[model samples]
Target: MTKVQTAKDVIEQTKFFHRKLADFYDNLSDNVEKERVKILLEYMSRHHENLAAILDDYESEISERVLDTWFMFVNKKCDLSPFFSASINPDMTAQQVIEIAVDFDQCLLDTYEGILQNEISDEVRDVFRGLLEMEKNEKIKLAKNALKIDSM
Candidate 1:
């Protein structure tokens, strides 16, 4: 790896915070109905896996700070949207679940891109950016299905 300067310190700290951010979403996998959020949650887990890898390479302080700040950041920023709540109700259509999943995936992708910009390593950033692109493609693929179901 190229010699990272002060940027390494900040990148490591950001990775730490993001790891917990990734972890919180990991926890959400168990929170809802089957076929509702499971696939989206799985996609989220991939990003968290990346974050965890970064964490493993970082020093103690950055890791610790990320663990500490994750909770508050999630509480304030995460959104369920009208799309997601519909998935939980029995009367709602299957298309709603697709919509929710697409949005959920998009949110995860957005965060990945944000983190990529702050990353010190091009290797790390490329991994995250690739994942973000994957998320977007998945979201698009799911969107057509969602609209198809709505028409039924």
Candidate 2:
């Protein structure tokens, strides 16, 4: 995606990130042999799709003034370097995949948190605060599901 300058740009970037992550999980599911891991990856892939849909809703409903407002670029820059540098193979265990997925969720949550800390308007804060809550709740749900999977 292009540079993150406005609120709408950030939403677009986040949507792009979710879509790419879903694709990654889908690819991993196809390459893996374990049925359980495949199912989990598929679930995660669907989860990302849901996130992207939420962003779409936000993009449509966001106030014009807020959408045009510029935001900080430091945290808006999503670095998937750690994820990209690693070697993901068919041999990778389900637990390892779960761990990675959890990390990805945490990173998204952290991004929203960083934005909240920056000096933005109340309108922007309210929008991001809602997103932050959703992210936080999703992380917890994912962790619970991961634990169940780990026990299997």
Task: Compare the candidates by lDDT and give the number of the best one.
Answer: 2
Please, what are the lDDT tens digits per residue for candidate 2 over residues 20-137? 8899898888988877788788888898899899889877898899989987745655556646864677777788888787767777877887778888999999988988898788
lDDT of 1 by residue, 61-135 (tens): 343333333211111243546333333542434444455555555556655555555533554455446556755
Can you list the residue pairs that collide in candidate 2? none
Query: Any idea what lDDT model 2 has?
Result: 0.80
TM-score of 1: 0.44
- Per-residue lDDT for 76 in model 2? 52
Candidate 1 global Cα RMSD: 9.7
TM-score on alpha carbons, each prediction? 0.44, 0.87
State residue 142's C-alpha deviation in candidate 1, in Å: 0.6
> lDDT scores for all predictions?
0.49, 0.80
Top-TM-score candidate index: 2
